[model samples]
Target chain A: MRLMSKPHSARELTGLLKAPTGIVGFDDVTLGGLPAGRPTLICGAAGCGKTLFGITFLVNGATLCDEPGVFMTFEERPEDLEANFRSLGYDLNGLAAAGKLIVDHVRVERSEIEEAGEYDLEGLFVRLGFAVDRIGAKRVVLDTIESLFAGFTDQAILRAELRRLFGWLKERGLTAVITGERGEGQLTRHGLEEYVSDCVILLDNRVEDQIATRRLRVVKYRGSSHGTNEFPFLIDEDGISVLPITAPRRNLAVCNEIVSSGIPGLDAMIRNGGFYRGSTILVSGVSGTGKTTMASHFVNAACLRGERCTFFSFEESAEEICRNARSVGLDLHAHVAAGLLRFEWARPSLYGLEMHLARMQRDIETFKPAVVVIDAISAFRGPAGDVQSILLRTVDLLKSSGITAMFTSLRSGASRDEGTDHGLSSIMDSWIKLVDVEENGERNRILYLIKSRGTSHSNQLREFRMTDRGIELIDAYIGPEGVLTGTARITQEARDRAAADQRERESNRRQRQFARRREAVRRQIEELEAALQAEEDEEAMLLGEDELRDATLKSDQAARAIRRRAAE
Target chain B: MTSDAERLDEGAQEAGEDAGHYYLRLYVAGHTTKSTLALNNLKRVCETHLAGRYEIEVIDLRENPQLAAGDQILAIPTLVRRLPQPLKRIIGDLSNTEKVLVGLDIRPKVACP
Candidate 1:
């Protein structure tokens, strides 16, 4: 045996090629579901719809592929299986009667079998082989093989028999679905089955927050590029449908027609027109920087312009968005009521990224929105894995549909650079960076037109103030100290202006004091001169009088000696 | 197929209700030590405390080869519980006893004897 092994150079490729399971929409998740001519194991706990899933595979093969199938049930009676599927609109009885489907129930009871002896499974093989040949079955399902183990106690013989049975099935090149009951720490009760099967799919039924959900995941597929995420699958009347959680197809065609950004000033900043009609725009900023408000403004603007818009809000409720938009001076309620704007609030993990994209695609195709706004794409980054790939695919999908897409991402710390968050910066055709600059003591929001592809954009950071009138992008605040930081800059500038006014007032006060002193001195001089003139007049009068007296007394002895001086 | 007297002696020797002791036999072909270690370890364990309760019957197919047909053994070193009613057989050597006891339906003692 050792000499015969020789590493078996004839390699059997198990996992690269996928056989299309002719189930509509099922191939999207399994990536061309199940391998043909190989046995696949479907393992799950009780009531996880493992049987329903298996039956769907058979029914789908018979109806869609025009291929006959055989379903062997160890647990349920054949009549019971037929009746249960009838509600789902499957005509199993008709198919069986028409020789399109063959269903067999192998009854095994441990109480009746006393001998644990070796017996050829040739009877079972013969039955299965005959059924396959009779219906020309391309697909076969064996529901639950654990009953065989329960019926027989000889583990040594049973193990070899199981190996032989699997080998026999594979040798026949029959594509088969084998269901197994999940065991603790083991893929199945007899764990050897997983080793023999070409593919293994795990179905899970869980109740989270009272909402029961059935999820399907490909545990192992020997030869195909199968999606590895646990996808939510619905088992309705039509059978099982798995939601594929991956990026939708991206279309790279750039749209040139300009559209309003909702804010007239904002539109002016990003060229004289606005953002391209179908390009993706990133509006990133810190908390309370009006990212959602901006998204709402865009939605409202689009609606007012008579274009349909979808707002996928991750954080806020639709009611809150509408109510808050009014405070920002945007009335979105009218647009919502008018059916121009649709608000869809979703938790990022509502499904995997691919399922989210598919739902969005469905909505977009149905509503045909001209603009799609994912309130903040960052919320989706956790489950979406790689950020750049998701954003690129999303942008491509939107652009391909000619729908303008706007995504808001919240940046951590103080950096306003677009390059901060991984590779998301590269995928955006336009980047609107909102920064909360701290200058002096207050915080002020500043919006900058970072990059707008194919259009001239304002390089200056415009100060945007949110008020009752809405978001107003004030003229770029250019001060002596350059662009101010936060709200403190505005207060500091105000303080400086006040201090300069105080200095000018002090100088005027000194000049007034000097002029007042000079005027008072001149007045005193004039008064003194008047008084001197009056005194001189008086002296002249007295002199005149003395002269008159002297003249009278000059004869009278030159009298009046002052008169004497005057007379002298 | 066997006499009632022989069946009685076999039943009396095997009927120690001590759940911890297991009478195990690993059927294998030849001097493969995987089988020898399984036999030696089982005997060493029986000598320690289950000297009375446990018995290991190691069947070598190279010598008493037809004995393999009695148990219908396929894989080597297949540990078989001869005393237990729902006779349990585990295909490897008793490398993992937790699986062995669970497979053999032996209620494990809180502390090994």
Candidate 2:
């Protein structure tokens, strides 16, 4: 019961009760959603999804928030509404069967009945009152009540009755959603906007440059402060979702957690181990510039760190992305199989940019992934002006949620977008631009970091090569013709090798000459020492013979002297 | 489902209630000055030429707004002739008696230019 119970007041209460619509990010913009138990008027032009938004509110009230709802439609048939909402997972029929919801279609045909005298709208009141009592609904939705005005000719009576109906709903204290058709000058065709003094929401469907976008704006909210900006909304299978353009960017909680950019070399280029956690990474390049490859590295790294990652590929299918990543040694398929990585692929040409954003937010909220990758945002075709809003909301949502996001964009030319016009390049915490440089009759991918906020990044244009072994980053060989890559890089390397070989050969020849000179000098010294030794030996022999002759003479003299002394 | 708050008083059912072969229906939005003026002007024209021969039905558009589509009443204070083999729709307050007479074909004299 607690699981399905209405969420307690998450924001500070100021004596106003707020009912959350459960629409994506709507409560954030509305401050706390619609004023609780008060009739809120939703008006829009045709095909603006006014009725669908009302239905989503009622369905969410009945299903998620455990508030039984009553859906009284004047425009669409009950069967048609049920069938249309089935795609959104709202089982209107089942809810009606379970006595949790009431779906009543008011059908008043002119030919079938006649009036003769004065009367009031007692019959309709009875029908609506009966349905409300039957379902015990706390939330009510009167979808497109303005259609009843077209049937009635007396504006005075219809306006009076509409005001009475709103007052009665408020008296009942039921959260009611009243949808109306937009008029030229007035908010509603019947001028029934008087009753919407509590809250008024306007939905607009605009088409510019062949792209259709649905925007929701809160024209007025009496009791609470609400977003005044036009928020882009999307209608998908789940239902209507509004993307609030202003995502509490200023007060967003920042962390010191460092996350990898997937490439070790690029990580080294950044100040931290990689990028700041929950930072937005913009990877832009021309076609086949390995933008997706770099994105894959980021995803692969996140998965390696045991963090959940979701990759949204607009141009490639899951299978194609898997196969392509495999070619570059990124095992994304295994990560997907392990449930650490999620892949969502959609063709950008098929859906509006708002729907893509809603689907992306839905995926993020459900997957609760730590990292999200949007590959190739340039392919998203829309009004060049409107694309900025979509991109801003996307980045803002991810950033506020503390989810690190990597967005890859394809460039039409050699220059990179500074994101000034597109609102993308400006808010990014880091930007890595991949460019394809033609060298030696081949295109080589070059990775360059244009900017990294709060981090010191390498300014070198790293030579990035994708091979079966994996993507390898090598120090660029700057030759006389500038930084080289591919075969030209190899050629520069070979030329450097030949130059080193020549220097080594020259040094070896000089050493050999020195060794030969030393050998010749040693032979000369040996011949001189032999001549000097021969001269010294001859002198020593002569001196020794002279000494011997002297010694013999002295001995004979001594003998003669001794014989004379003995005779005396 | 269609029972309450509707009074369908047909000439055949209400006998002797302004006995006439012609059936007239006047549609008005509540009791406004325009609606009262149109009703008074229409009765004066009908009584003059079709006294006790026509049955007039006053239908309040505010009571049964759905009935407007049946008679194709675009503007309030409209007079519709349902009988005499031809359908005629006249709109406005019916202030000009001669014009109303000519419009209803009450007399050829009033109808002539």
Candidate 3:
């Protein structure tokens, strides 16, 4: 963020002024832009965009910097150049008509000319000076000055004339761009780099594995400190935009707002009820593990919340994705028609990884979506390291823009490793890994919250199923046999129910037997008491008969017996 | 088509039409030594070969700098053959007479003289 905020102010401190190139990310890479009022040599091989680079500089200078420019071509004609750069949206005719540019073609044919004696390039100087004065141009571009070598046969005279040309350009205080053809070992075939001593940039178009990537590097910037690394650049319909490798480190703004992940079951896993707004989430899994399903759910949820979403799909077309989402009860088509969701689909082999990233970045910038979903980043063809670095930059862009981004990576193997195949799990704020568990003659999808940086998340392996309704996260069976899903979980649950039933039945039988024994003991005690009472009664009767025999002699004994009976 | 020597023979060259007449334009920056030498060499060559049939026009670019873009000039002391079916240019001071004649397509007819 603090790189080059005010270039004018920076000039005061560094004593070197810069002219902004107006190319995206290019100014930052150069700490501002090319040194102002000086010549910069841009060297590259054939068809490597040397002319385009020079044209972009001139066009941008004319339209953006309020500075008129002179484009002197040593090869192609003005009409051919105009037609070639028309696709890039540069109106050469209009600019020239507006007096903001001048196109001068320096045609030199060797077959029609003979050098009989000494001659200087005074004619070239006069023409260039006239054009520059006509437009009061501040910038000048000599597209591939190396063509002079093919046109002229005198090396000594040509070299001396070139040196004088550069000196003349500098004396006029014009910021110049002189493109050169790359030599075998030197920066330029004629070593023009030795003459232009202010700045030197190299453009390279390299093809590896049949995929071409364009890169730009600032080899030397005299009296200025600039980024020294080779940066990936793209030339599309909008013109050139360079992607600097270094991501915004600590300057990204932190957000506390949370958005749901669509599935309540999954949202419940996160401590904040969902992912942080503007945080990068990676959903990695093997084939048929519902990576796209999870990403779609997020998109659906974002759209439902009245937030715009951009879904970038590398594997499936928009129609196919909408159809699949319909089966899962997510009407992505409705959101799309509502203008809340946009789907961009491109094949993985369409372009280089950096190009894809640049295009996606451009789309995001234009759409200004609150949420973005990249379905299957693994489909991008490149080395793991390159893909990871590109993803790192992508994530940085999203985070710095405060846009919630979700990227799905297709893991080739169902390994237990929590990292993505490209090793992007580290830079992600949240990483959810999905794997299919095969047990009980069936395979079931399970999700594991591998890493969540800013929020607490469930570490359990959540069993999820994609039914016709949607993806539902069910409680995985956690037992001594480890986490089980699908039929294994169902069978374990049934076995647990039967064990509970048998334990209840055995307790009921034991209680009944104990009650029967207690009832028998009570009845035996009652019988023994009855026998004792009978024996007491018989003894009392015998005493009463002996008393009656005595009652014949005395009536008082009967009265005494009656009184005794009354007392008892 | 009038050279310095042909101007002397203008009365005799007046009968000749525009065709079969050599028209040469020499482009020079200033009155430099090389431009002077190229101009003198051309006059000598015309007198020796076509004489009254050749015409030479000397243009000094130092006065009218913008005129340099007319013929797409990059070198000083450049001689352009304007007449005949095909046009040709010879850069540098015309010190080499044979090469200048070949460049101007004045060789085959030089044998007649």
Candidate 4:
């Protein structure tokens, strides 16, 4: 009957009334939050952030939701709890002073306490009721209520009392969070799960390969659809934040506008002149392959356009990156000074991949950058599956926010395949593979445009050179010897030039020899014509003398004929 | 037994007036059966061992539940010995006399060599 009852608000569609926890990415995973006005059990081992989770929930409820909450810590003193939460910037004392929160430390010291006869925990109920009623609290947190087991010897009485207490809390219509220590095989050491069955969240901190990652999972949410995946959460100075990688889907606003890739040559390789405005570009290469330099160029171009950019560097410090960028003729420090560029650097080993993503997401949210550059995603070295999954989520977050992102991955060895070691090339809108072309006993960098979605790009590998001026993408020489780079290309080009010069010189010599012979033949023909003219003149003279008289030739012929006829 | 108790009281009084005096506070939720039993047992023990040398302060949490926080009370029928240098707390109805005497440090002082 209870299961059949509709516990949701009348205005909302069929489901329980949810309470938004105001934690980053937590609400999306829980479909909203824990079941409202109901008890949710949070079980975890020691040092797994069970207490912090409860405190954060209560604090968020009081501060953000405007709902007063009561935090009854069974293990920590009120002052100690306040001191611990202060590191997260949570002013518990201030909230308590404002009457928005009530922290009641239920100290049960077994050493000083002696059990003489039968008893019940009515005093606890009275104190809790008083605190709750004083602040009109809508949320209650019983942190590690299992500590009561250490104080009481009568397990039966404690169980009965706890069941009654849960019922009383439910009747009061208060949202409650009960934390318990992890058991050997059960959800909680004392089986608190049997009492608070409406919702259950499990917090875990696991260390693998010497890297610890905190994860939160909603094991069950009665009457609600929730994300069953183990969401990675981070507890930093700001507080606990869960990364709901599965919630942000691929349906993001696609922009047609393109942004330059900083290097003019690199931009020219893409058909659109640049990458799409909100696209994810993966630049994979081995060590010292000019990946970071290319990313610097991109960030510089974005900053030059007066657009904000965030550069997350996991391998190097901001100063080191800025200094390195300066070597490539990019003044990133100036952009940083101009407030157009922000460099965030952290060691990948300091946190798990998901934490880095969550921090990056938060940075993007606060800075509202138009472009983001992750200098080397490979610095987050771990299982390929985890690295790729986090990268996919990071890309999704950037795409959903309509921010252009460039991720540089470090490929191991000389693998020239299109696939990145992290297997993140598929989700990328554009993938640029950088490799070392070892030729002529020297290594040179070459960049290939592996794929660019929705845009045509040059498939040819360009000799990626980090010139003093900037990056230069020269068209690689595709000779019979395959692709040539470095000094090998230069030597081949010089040899071709010398051979062309020799061919031109031979043709010039042949042309000169032919012109000289033709001139000699023309002179000979002219001399012969002169001689023939002289001979003809002489003949004419002789004829004219013989027939004077024969009246100068042809006239002489007519005159001769007339004379002949007269003589006959 | 009366003479021995008087001599022990004189020796405790010589040290300080508060030394021989017992300040006991019982925290309970109204006049429940366990609360009453605990109160009666505590009074009987005090009268027999520390008659006229003890003071009992009964705190009915139902009348003023806010007072429970001061003593860090959680269980019903709780007795707190406030006057001793190191305070002690005994929970549950004070029906077990031997355990109560040991918990309140009354039997050890009487049995001292």
> What TM-score goes with each of the models?
0.52, 0.69, 0.78, 0.82
**Model 3, chain B: what is the TM-score?**
0.78
Q: Weakest 10 consecutive residues, lDDT, candidate 1 chain A?
A: A1-10
Worst 10 residues of 2 chain A by lDDT: A1-10
Q: What stretches of model 4 exceed 4 Å from their correct place? A: A1-15, A247-255, A337-339, A353-368, A385-403, A414-420, A426-429, A453-456, A476-484, A488-568, B1-18, B109-113
Q: lDDT score, residue A164, model 2?
A: 74
Which 10 residues in a row give candidate 4 chain A its minimum summed lDDT?
A1-10
Best candidate, TM-score:
4
Q: Model 4 compared with the native: what TM-score?
A: 0.82
Per-residue lDDT tens digits of candidate 4, residues A334-400?
9999999998888999887777887898888879999999978878878878888887788778888
- Provide chain B's TM-score, model 1: 0.66
| Candidate 2, residue A67: lDDT | 88
CA lDDT scores, all candidates in order: 0.73, 0.78, 0.86, 0.87
lDDT of 1 by residue, A225-290 (tens): 678888767665556667664455554565667888988889988765788888788998888888
Task: Output the TM-score of candidate 2.
Answer: 0.69
Task: Give the alpha carbon lDDT tens digit for every residue of A1-568 in model 2.
Answer: 1121123222323567888899887888898778887888899889999888888887788878888888888767889988888888889999889888888777544432332222345345555666677678889898877766656555676677777788788778899899888888988876657766678999998875566768889998765788898887878776777876554566777888999887777888877768999899899888888888888989999999999999999998889888998998888989999999999898886667877887788788889999999987887887777688778878888987899999998877745544443668778988888888875678888888988899888899988888886678887887687888888888879989999999999999999999999999998999999999999999999999999999999998999899999999
